[model samples]
Target: MKSTTSALLNRIEFPVLLAGLLIAAGLWGFVELMELARAATPHAFDTEILLAFRHAGQPDNPIGPLWLQGAMRDITSLGSTSVLVLVTTATIIYLLLIRRPAAALLMFVAVAGGKVLSILLKFEVDRPRPELVSHLVNETSLSFPSGHAMLSAITYLTLGSLAARFLPDRTTRIFVLGLAVLTTVLVGISRVYLGVHWPSDVLAGWCAGFAWAMLCWLAARLLQRRKVLADSE
Candidate 1:
């Protein structure tokens, strides 16, 4: 029994353990945010943060300069459905062209699965978009978990991690992953800045998005170990 336990422990590497912890933390954070979303009144923090983006007396006027609002619109579009679809499709095509069909399929599944999950969570929470401030950009969907934030995280992080595998050096890999995270963070912040989503909504989106991305990564790792998915050459 002691030997068996030792062997099992030896198989659990630090990266795997860290991924497991991140998944747990993400899920717990998401659940707690969901409770807040379900409350009748928005959390004080959510209101205060959302209002902070706008002028003190005028909800219609955002805090930043005109150019900044335009820039935010561009950034937020990075997480838009059309843009994400384009990016995911292009990446999948590239992977297929390189003869990495397994990786391509996994990428498709990760993004598609995240999209469906986002829709389900939005409906489940049934939270309306914040009306405390004027929306800089129009959004019609139910807005508990920002679809833009969650999907951006899932897509960018998945692509980043996958691309990192094919990179030749550690620094390049880290840079790619860092850019992905940065883009995801910007997208989330843009949602808030545009006053289309509450702060909690973005937070929930990040939690769920990170968790789902990590879950997919862990699954891919397992499949590679089992020879079900070929490792990147």
Candidate 2:
């Protein structure tokens, strides 16, 4: 019995350990990107990309409607606070209703904590918004780590993971994850298109977002294992 329990603990701990290592790696990668973005002087490539991204907000682009523009703008304005509070409340209610306190708590922390980490990274990097082109939409934050990209990744991926719980097949699970990733990518692109962020900024956001999502998934997996062990006892 002791050996079996030890093995279970090892299995359960693996994901958390992996996540911690990944988070550390992500932090290093984000720092490296920041250094590169900062050290490189603005070039023609930056100028061209900035122009193109800002152009996306123009009336001529059929891909983006006025309403969608308005929505993205609104979401960007919420900063990190909106998602944190919303996810927290929702997770609490969900846990209470479903009687899965561990899972709920883990989800809440993963989402909420991701938001907080995003903010800290933003301040730490302090990369200015692009000056090569004028912004079509309103934006007033540091541009290195795109907030919309980060939040969309966290929120969508979290929800997708939860959704996958009900899905039995591997294909369905992959589909859910793909959808979450696609949404995150679209949101990041929209930021660039609206001239609110640079392509490099979006790239950094993607890296950071991916890293954070992996960490959150790791936490959730660990929580699930704990629940499984509890049930066994």
Cα lDDT listed for each candidate: 0.94, 0.69
Per-residue CA lDDT of candidate 2, range 1-233, in tens? 99999888777666466667767886687776777667667545555776664345543352446787677665554334565467657766876576766556656766777778778878987878876655657678788788777777777777777667769998999999899878777777777766767777777777787688777677566556676412112
Model 2 is weakest, by summed lDDT over 10 consecutive residues, at 224-233
What's model 1's lDDT at 60? 91
Q: Pull out the clashing pairs in model 2.
A: none
For residue 31, give model 2's deviation from the true position in Å. Answer: 3.4
79-189: candidate 1 lDDT, tens digit per residue = 999999999999999999998988898899999999999999998989999999999998999998999999999999999998998999999999999999999999999
Cα distance off (Å), candidate 2, residue 64: 8.0
Root-mean-square deviation of candidate 2 = 5.8
